[model samples]
Target: MPPAHPFDDDKLREECGVFGVVGVADAASFVALGLHALQHRGQEAGGIVTHDAETGFNQARRIGLVRDNFTSPEMMARLPGPIGIGHVRYSTTGSKGQTAIRDVQPFFGEFAMGGAAIAHNGNITNALQLRRELIERGSIFQSSSDSECIIHLMARSMGRNIPDRMEEALRKVEGAFSIVAMTRTKLLGCRDPLGVRPLVLGKIGDGWALASETCALDIIGAEFVREVKPGEMVVITAEKGVESHFPFRPNRSRFCIFEHVYFSRPDSILGGRSVYETRENIGRELAKEAPVEADLVCPVPDSGTPAAIGYALESGIPYAMGIIRNQYMGRTFIEPTEQIRNMGVRLKLNVNRALIKGKRVILVDDSVVRGTTSRKIKEMILDAGAAEVHFRIASPPTAWPCFYGVDTPQREKLLAATMSEEEMREHLEVDSLKFISLDGLYRAVGEAQGRDDNAPAYCDACFSGEYPVAPSDMMEQGFQAKTAAE
Candidate 1:
């Protein structure tokens, strides 16, 4: 059996994070540092692939944290090269077991033209359909991962160069993707047309870096250059520097808004805005939309802290640490069984009885998916002798499942899919519950006038049920979209 997850299982999980660097000495070490910074994006497995002129290619793929797997000098010494790419993976499409290691990436493939290794972030919605077609046409796959489809597609492409073949391969795939790939002579990066996931460009010494977030670049002292534009491919080579190409038709960018609310590290910048600042703005907006009288404002801890600070500032309520998190616990939601999940909250967090007793408390959290966590936390606060509890959710109710890389539960499993705000309040036994408005979220992200109904600035499909990309494989598998409630 898989290890029991005793963390916040109700939360949505990001699929993976990708990083690549060219022209750096001991490039695998730099890639490892970058992956360590992005460890929050994934925790199950990590891998790095490097290419040297004399040694050709070297790879290290392990099923654990970057620090645990890649920190050894012996391991780093084995992967010596001047060009490398790495990935931190949390499986979204493949099985979870010892066999799953086969899917752990920086998946390397040898082509007629040359050899390339690819690490990908985000989901390919049409992957199943494409995989079936490819298999029927005589493609032998190494793993069940959706990302492997890219390699198969590249093998069949008629384009001359690796970059050209990559562009051709991407044209046949659908949904969100931000890919980092490495060849003997080049490191390449690209984002999908919709830009559903993030990919940033950075510089360190004479080397160039491509990473899922700026925080990864910061870890190795890489100066942020800019984001790789949606639908654009960049190839970085020592002799030619960086060459850019637009492989897909240009489309209006639809960056995932959840990155600001929960996915990214607070210190990272996305789309010219600080993720921490956007979250704080969300709290301020929540305060305006739903003002509540309370003796203390307390965050759920970690993910909820910044928004809670902003909430207290806006509402003039005292901010206090009513709940304490155990520093050693990995996120509890990753546990596989119900028994472990039931014990997750207690293992990860505890109520501060001294602080919460006799206080009318307001709890600020990033989002509520299944309501399981909210219910458990409310019980904990009440048991600690809190007079009353109110919930201030930073994001709107997540009613729809995300098909673009985020691992959200089925529609029926989503609490908001069936319950209204009042209904959820009653379900959680909280004094009240209020989620930030959809337009309020847009404003918090810096769209001051609110979401443009005609052309919304960001993707809010989970709240609005207005999917920008058609989830083709899901539709074929009999999944239907749910309508948003008033």
Candidate 2:
């Protein structure tokens, strides 16, 4: 197997983004707008699906950002409908299996029972088992994503209505998920029992909306209502205002802690906690746990920049932009080779030698999945004449694969996974290094919740060894063998 860059050093990728609407005049357009609001979640691809009684269903999907793919002109030309669903996908399973337009969401399928399309957030832990079982029974597969596994399960179930099949499918699949789907006449939203991912419901006049983040609701003038609870499923239709059901009884409401630490947008709120506050807490905690003497606190780039601000404020040290990232560059920029990307880093970020020269700087970053990018950044800082660089990480080590949605690689490739903090510090060749204690992590996010404990039972398994669900064979096929070599 080749080396897999599942958890590259640049940034840990979020799994997917989902948006759905009902009773809107320009349903496809509104979904496009909503997906645009969530463009930060996933940049690999964007798609939309709409349905009207008069024209049936129509869809537009492409490989790019929502803004680039679903423009106003494109949205206007799309067949108008009253109900719709949209998805922005990032790869959890990067095998070529689901990278195509057909494999991308919103995934469509027609069965003898009926037909439906699903746009999903989060990874299915048991997807491989389910896919194998379905395959043995002659269930054909279109995409490699575990998200497609649910569609097949729902289609094959002996249920008359879409909701019935959905319920049956939900019962069979295990792990973290926040799924939004649409049938000919209805729009639906469902969260996994543990709610490892965030999902919310909102309203705009007579219309209703569902999105992975509240920021999306604000984008299209929707009132932020409330979060969809774990173990709950919601169905919205023309006849009913909003119907709710809990196929799975209450389990621990373990929303992913990383969402607060890194994944979600700063403006978005997840599980009643503000992402900005969570990041601030990490900064404050990093200050308390690993105080350092430095002329300036510098963030690696965008994600770490916020935490760096917090750390600067708490430590009473001024924050400076040591490295500047190129906002124009897309993740899939046409760099055909790693050496090209390595050269592109200078294009990606440049050091302001004026600020760092002759100064002992404290460098803050979200996490170090692999040692490559961090090493380059450190050398860049040193070359810019920083007297010393002290590295502070906001989260604990990412030593395990996330069975949920995040695409962390197998344990071995992660520097912190196999090496001690001191060993990793040597690997990166920084002057000194420190990571926020696991207890400190929970303390930061937990403080915002008004709870004394560090982390509310969210999925911290990426930082800690505890996993919400074991990695499925699908995850094994997608990441393990590839990650081992990297």
Candidate 3:
């Protein structure tokens, strides 16, 4: 039976994350290490493709985490090459129910022009429209992901250079994306015009690496290089590394601010800001905005733990692990069929009755999506004898589905998306609930609005609907009604 939470809603859905390395003896091994670092961005499927003079493109993929997928020693030994690209995927727009090996990536195709394999992050808002158009033009699609559309488009573009062809293909598509492409002799990286997803370049010992986060570089002992500029494409080959300008001037980089707020690991660096510092800053700002009296400040677990530390330090509240997380549960845990999805939260976390007995507690969390998990956790705490549970969200309420890659429920499903703080408090049965203001969040990211000379940055569309790319469908749906909707 499918797990109770068949949707995998407990963890944020990562569209995908990519890694590429060249001129390394242990190219496949290093690529595996990089993918392991990026495993947090995606967990559903993993793959790697290598390039060598003997074999143009050798590949392997499986339906699980990097460690699970690349478990066979034979699989690693077979992938002998000095250059390669790896990927981890969690589908956003495609068939979430699919378990087919063909659907896993580093998708490769052999064309009259030559052969190329690709890995990508982000979702195309106009994918439906573009897919229909491509189909009409006789471009057959193998996978449901909007990502496949780019490859077909690249094949069709009649540009002079590979980079120009890539540019032409990107010009035809709209939405958030950060792509990495590999051929027999080249590795290429591109960011969406708005820079909604992140891509970073790194350098080491006459070789280069590209990945979704700086954390990956740190894992492989590569020196950090600059971020791939918004709307820019860079192609690396034995000959030279090529960078081209954005086709048109973008107003500013609309990077997914959530990368700092929740999606990225606290140890990574993004958009010139330390992800950990940004999260802590949010906690400090949240504490300043809404001071609560409590015996201890406790985090939801994992993602919420760093913010809780900040909140504890700023509010002068002692911090404690009021809830303990079960370390054994993973993507394949057997629970959905026998257990309820709402009850799934307890499989991973249980309230420590000893820690919260008769004490007022402040709960710090990154954000509340469907509210099922939060509600369940809150109930567990109260049942454990807490005098009161006050909830503080590190970021503003998320009211919109993220087309960029985040897997949020429909509008009406989000608790805060539909209701006010008061309404959420009543609904979740918490003593109080408060969220950080959008302004406070921006301030915490450590950048002034107008400071950066290249790329003015601000893309909080999930909170403020000022999208760099418009939704193909007219009306927005699926967010929850505000707590106090009248």
Best by TM-score: 1
In candidate 2, what are the lDDT values of residues 107-208, reduced to their tens digit? 887867556889999888788788889999999897787888888898778987889899999998888999999988789999999888989999988889
- Select the stronger candidate by lDDT from 1 and 3: 1
lDDT of 1 by residue, 1-486 (tens): 242233667788866999999998999999999999999898889999999888899998998789889999999999999999999987777765342778999999999978999999999999999999999999999898999999999999998989999999999999999999988989999999999899999999999999999999999999999999999999998777789999899899999999999999999999999999889999999999999999999999889999999999999999999999988775333544677656758877899999999999999999999998889999999999999999999999999999988888899999999998899889998999999999999999999899998898777888888888888999998988644453
- Tell me, what's the RMSD of every candidate? 2.1, 4.0, 3.5
For all candidates in order, the CA lDDT equals: 0.91, 0.82, 0.80
User: In model 3, where is the ten-residue run with the lowest total lDDT?
Assistant: 477-486
The segments of candidate 2 whose C-alpha lies over 4 angstroms from its true place after superposition are 1-9, 72-75, 94-98, 111-114, 331-334, 337-339, 447-456, 472-486
Pick the lDDT winner: 1
> Model 1: residues >4 Å from true position, as ranges?
1-5, 97-99, 331-342, 482-486
TM-score of each: 0.96, 0.92, 0.92
